[model samples]
Target: MTTTKERALDAAICLAGSQGIRAMTHARVDAAAGLPKGSTSNHFRTRDALLAGVIARIAEGERADLAPAARGPIHSIDEFVDVFTAVVTTLTGPHADRTRARYALFLELSSDPELQAPLRAQRAAFAELARILLAGLGAKHPDAAVEAFMAFGDGLILHRLTVDPGAPVRRSVAIAVRGCLEA
Candidate 1:
């Protein structure tokens, strides 16, 4: 069973994803979660707290989804593509709403430098993971490859999220990974 905190956080994510960050107030989260008024506020006392919770939740969900690929070092282009495909499909499919919400929150929180720490940490973690994978893939400069791959993935995700939901993201991911690996 989901805890009240988790429910409220989930509701916040869904609300942000579907209706944008402006719709993610505590009262709205409580109503969306079917919890009593002030329930969300009880868990997260401030808007920053709520935004942080949403960011942390998104990271947790992504870590779980990507766990399978983290079991071992990626050994080949095909293996990497398979993992990339799974990730892209999830991001562009079932998790699209939350992903969109994240982007919305990212933009909304940009003016609040203090609220951006978790997002920066998340990006750093992804970059570290990409560095490891790129090294294993024999990229000439793993650090540069990490930056390029992340930029490609982020751009691809953002484009697919906003403009063309039906874009062949998996194929695009494969191409991008192939280019990174071959460069």
Candidate 2:
């Protein structure tokens, strides 16, 4: 069973994705979650607290989704592209709302370093993993490869989310993977 906090956070993500940050209030989250009024506030206590909780929830979900790729060995660029293409597919399909919510939060809280800590840490972990994979793939400069791959993935995600939901994800992944290999 989902805890009250989890339900509230899930609802918050949906609200943030659908209505943007300004509309994601404690009462609204409670209503969305089908919890009693004040339930979300009881867990969060403040807007910053709620935002922090939502960020943590998003990071937790993303980390879980990435765990497999991080653990599995990618012996070739094709395998790497396939793994990340699947990740992008999930992000833009079943998890689209949560992915959108994460992007919305990123925009709203871009200037707040404290609020962005979890995201930054998660990003660092991903970059490290990408770096290792790129090195194994014989990238001349793993650090630069990691940066290019990260940027391309982010751009592709944003484009797919806002411009074309049916955009070819594997093609983008292949481009990023090849660029990383060449970097």
Candidate 3:
């Protein structure tokens, strides 16, 4: 019941999730989407085009996740915690195995430089969003605050990926945030 374009992006997301960006060929995507094997090419002439679509979809989701903070003054550190918690929830899932697999997907992304540009840009956008949030935190150097927060948050995820967390991502973020900021 979906359009060819829809099928193509769906396939791209699932393929990239399961096999990483490099393995997301037209043939693989078509098979994943349950559409004709040539539909990826029919909708997106090249791999770049298909990958672009995938980035667009994922970035859109990321933006949606930060919708509230993006629009308002994110002064309360508590509010950032809420937003970061939701974002981490999406990455980690409600289950431990899903969280581990999501971390693996994060690893898969690191291996695909060609497909990482859009992802990098989206990350910049999130950084800018954090700058806006930092302005509310009474920090004179918004850029520095953004960098610090992102670095700490990312390190937390990477550490959790390699550790056996009894309380999981929500707890991990809480601990990281507490350590990253002062009372």
The prediction achieving the highest TM-score against the true structure is 2
**Sort by TM-score, best first: what order?**
2, 1, 3
Q: Give the Cα error of residue 38 in candidate 1, in Å.
A: 1.3
Of the pair 1 and 3, which is ahead by lDDT?
Answer: 1
The Cα error of candidate 2 at residue 14, in Å, is 0.7
The parts of candidate 2 lying over 4 Å away from their true place are none
Lowest lDDT 10-mer window, candidate 2? 64-73
Tens digit of per-residue lDDT, candidate 2, span 68-132: 68986789888888888988888888888889988888788899999988878887888888889
TM-score of each: 0.94, 0.96, 0.75
Ranking by lDDT: 2, 1, 3
Model 1 regions more than 4 Å off: none
Per-residue error for 94 in candidate 2, Å, reads 1.1
Give lDDT tens digits, candidate 3, residues 35-136.
Answer: 887888987898768766767766666677667667777656677777787776655443323334334445666878766766778778878877676666
lDDT of 1 by residue, 84-121 (tens): 77887798789987888878877898988788778778
- lDDT measured at residue 106 in model 3 versus the true structure, 0 to 100: 52
TM-score of model 2 relative to the true fold? 0.96
